[model samples]
Target chain A: MTIKQIERLRKGAITLLMLAISILFLLPFLWMLSASFKIEADVFTYPIQWIPAKWHIIENYKEVWIGKFPFYKYYWNTVKVTVLTTVTSAFVSALAAYGFSKINFAASKYLFIIVLATYMIPHQAILVPQFILYRQIGFFDSHLGLILLSSFSVLGTFMLRQFFMGVHNEYIESAKIDGAGHWRIFWQIAFPLVRPAVATYAILRFIWTWNDYQNPLIFLRTDKLYTIQLAMQKFTTINGEFYSLIMAAAVSAILPLLIVFIIGQKSVIEGIALGGVKG
Target chain B: MQKLETAAEAPKAKHISKRSSLQKKETIAGLLFVGPMLIGVTVLTFIPIIATFLLSLADWNFIAGFKDIKWVGFDNYERLLQDDGFMKSLKNNAYFLLTVPIYLAISMLLAILIDKHVYMKSYFKVAYFMPYISSIVAVAIVWQVLFHPSAGPVNQLLISFGIDNPPKWIADPKYALPSLMMISIWISIGFNLIVYIAGLQSIPKDLYEAADIDGANAWHKFKSITFPQLSSTSFFLLVTGIISTFKIFDLIAILTKGGPISSTSMLVWHLYDTAFVNLKIGYASSMAVILFACVMLITVLQWLGQKKWVNY
Candidate 1:
């Protein structure tokens, strides 16, 4: 065979391999989408239906959204908590990062280390006491409690601190020369410069809060206050036999994140990558 | 605004005083800036941690409040040594950690393949990474449907291949933990792939060119150049993965509920069940302490061990 023919053969093999792996990775998502639209009996039919023969799209989605349990309530609860948590976390962490990086005060280094040391404390280890404290402080059984618990993250503070540290001290000095207060400096100069980093952490915080189950499970007791994850758990347990309904609910639960991934694809990859390598 | 005029009107030596006051103002501003976090970390994290440790020492049904608490000293810790539930959960965590190596291999392989001047790079990346960003609850539900006993696609396929019987998976005692591990592996490989791709991209091209000039084969190039360069990323993944695997709760909660005779239970699951369901506050706190200890010990050991070979 000619050299060109051999090269073409190698390329063909690689392309085929790539396609196979991509399809394999995408199979679960495909199954979820296809199964959501399939009829109850057709949902699990053999040969793995790539496409549903009998589309039950309206019926399945309608039952999930406004049926007996009203899944959209949980969806709205999640949206409320997610938005509040992400905004609060990003803002709080940014302030803390600015303080830790730029300001020099008594025991600043030790205090920062002490904050980071909390990362070593397992979430469950703190849960027992936090649960008690929540009861005492009137934070139990409400979205407010879940929101408070989710809003403060040590990892987000640490991640954003790295970006803040990259900002030159000369800017702080020049701003001071202009009689700009520290708050002004933080609001105007440092934040905008690291907006991408802040945005990265914010997007991640949004996803984490939206997907968080443990906090909602432990802190929330009211059926009306449940996040989508908590609701999904209850829904699946109660409706295990209804594959069509469960898959439709799964599709609804994942739709937001899928849209998020599509829109912020590059930033999400970069955020996790940066977060990983830094660790 | 008037402060500047007053400073100018005063002695020139007072210039130093103005600057000093500004520094003082900054100190207060710094405290004020970090005040919310300080209060948060203390109330939610720092105090809870200390409180958890103290609570572990006492016997309390958690109904009568702190006033009715009884100190049991080391009794809870003693019970952990004898608890079969605790031991089984620990073993299950070890089994779950088995996913780490499989994840590393599959993610690494895909990274190498896609790294080789592949076309439609972003398209391939999005497809592979879709699962990592997906909510675990949704993933579990779909997998539950797929793994259904009689009518599910997975069992149906196995039957068509002429196997008389397949494991009940997620419901069977022997297959429960392993089944969860499989779902974990499926959900996790996307993250590993993204991290590995980033690691591969950071490796310089000249390393490959230098290998080519020496007539080195792909295997040789990979061993010498690729492996060392990616070692740091792999080490990071290893330590973090170990820490995270110790805290595996969401999947167990959604998929198995630490059930079918507690086959899929991990430390977090056991702790949750103990504290919330059974109301064994003291006992569960002890378990949480152990969980924290294991995570810390593994992290410290990894940090110290990385001194051996993780080249920056």
Candidate 2:
């Protein structure tokens, strides 16, 4: 055989291996998706019902969505908190990034160093005082407080600043020569240039906020105020015996994230690429 | 207005004053732009951390309010040394660090294979990355069903393989933390793989070409060229991955809730349980401080250790 044929054969074997591994990696999620459509007795069937024989899809979903402990409220709560937190975090981080990177000032270096250092202090380490502080400030048990907890991210600021630093000084200078003020230059010239980086950060922030279980678990007391994560936990405990309903709840909780990922995967991959190269 | 005034003034004086004025404007703008984050960090992070330290020194139930804060000198720390739960949690967190190297190795191998030989790279990337992006609550719940003692698919597969008695994962105390670690490794390999693949792509082709010219095989080239070039990415993933292990709360909260026997209880979960569930604010604060110290120590050690191996 030619060397090219041998190479092709090797590639074919490796591709098949990767396909098998990927299927194994996806099996749990596929099972979850499949189980959501199955009747209760069919869920635990051996050999695994890769596809449901008797579909209870509508009934299962309806039970999760409109039954006791309805998911729509949690969904709405999660969407509100995730959107607000992402926008606030992305904008705040971008503004800080631009300040640190583009607008030179005496305290820029020191202030940025301070912010970077704070990123090392784990959030878990500070939750105690934050809880007390929130209680004192009347922010405890409130979604507004939950939003504020993650809105000003040191990591986000630091990540975005790396991208902002890539914005050439010449552009900002030329804009300055055109009589554009700092704010005007930032909004028009600097920000637009780094908009893709900001979008990447925003998508990440959205995912983080959406998946956040700890904050909602800690801060939210009212059932009405619970985020999707909290709701998922609650639903599972209440429906522990009902596998089909639990699977439906799990799917409902994860479906939005899947949608977000599908739409924004290009940005997500770029973000990861940037992170890799930054190292 | 400043530019007009500077134009009308003496040339040398105007140049100096204009420079200072521009500097002043820039400083003001910089401060304004950074104001929200600066305040937010100060109010939310800076104050809370300092308060965490201070609160750790005093015994106070949050429900009892400010009037009840009684200063206890080193008592919480002393008690922490004797607390079995805290000790167990500390041990579990250290054990959980095993997952970092576990996933890193698997991801590095997968990354190499996929980068050079696989078809539909993005298809595999997305499939693996899905779990990383999925809510831990949902992931935990799904795994709960999969890990069911008898009827679960995992054990069912094991049964078919002729192991009649597969370990009861997540339900058995001995297997709970290990099960959590397994889930963690599964969730994180994709992110690590994505990062590793990117690192692999960035490796210069000339080095490989030079190695090929020198009659170097794949393993030799990988060892001398690829691995060293990817060291920085590895370091990055290592630090982030270890830090994330310390923050493994969601899975524990969902799957084990610190377990049938506190076997899966890590520092964060113990801290949460102490502070929220038991309402031992000061006790939990001490745990938090220990958590802070441990994270700081590990990070510093990694930083000091990196100079020996990390290329960048």
For each candidate, the alpha-carbon lDDT, in order, equals 0.86, 0.89
lDDT of 2 by residue, A1-279 (tens): 999999999999998989989987888888999999999999988888788999999999998999998999999999999999999999999999999999989999999999888978989999988988888899999989999999998888988899889989999899889899989888898889889888888888899899999899888899999998999899988887898999899899889989999999999877976764211
* Model 2 agreement with the true structure over B1-312: per-residue lDDT tens digits: 998986777697878899999899999999999999999999999999998898899898888878998999789999999999999999999999999999999999999998888778889889888888888889989999899999889999999999989999999998988898999999988889999989999998898999989999889988999888999989888988888888889899889989888899999999999999888898899989988998898789888988987874
TM-score of each: 0.95, 0.96
Query: Residue by residue across B36-155, what tens digits does model 1's lDDT show?
Result: 988899999999989888988988888767788889999999999999999999988888889888888888888887777466778888888877777888888878777877777888
In the predicted model 2, the residue pairs found to clash are none
How does residue B58 of candidate 1 score in lDDT?
84
Q: Which stretches of candidate 2 lie over 4 Å from their true place?
A: A276-279, B1-14
Give per-residue lDDT, candidate 1, residue B110.
84
Candidate 2: lDDT of B269? 96
User: i-RMS, every candidate?
Assistant: 1.7, 1.6
Question: Residue B197 error for model 2, in Å?
Answer: 0.8
Each prediction's RMSD to truth: 3.9, 3.3
The iRMS of model 2 comes to 1.6
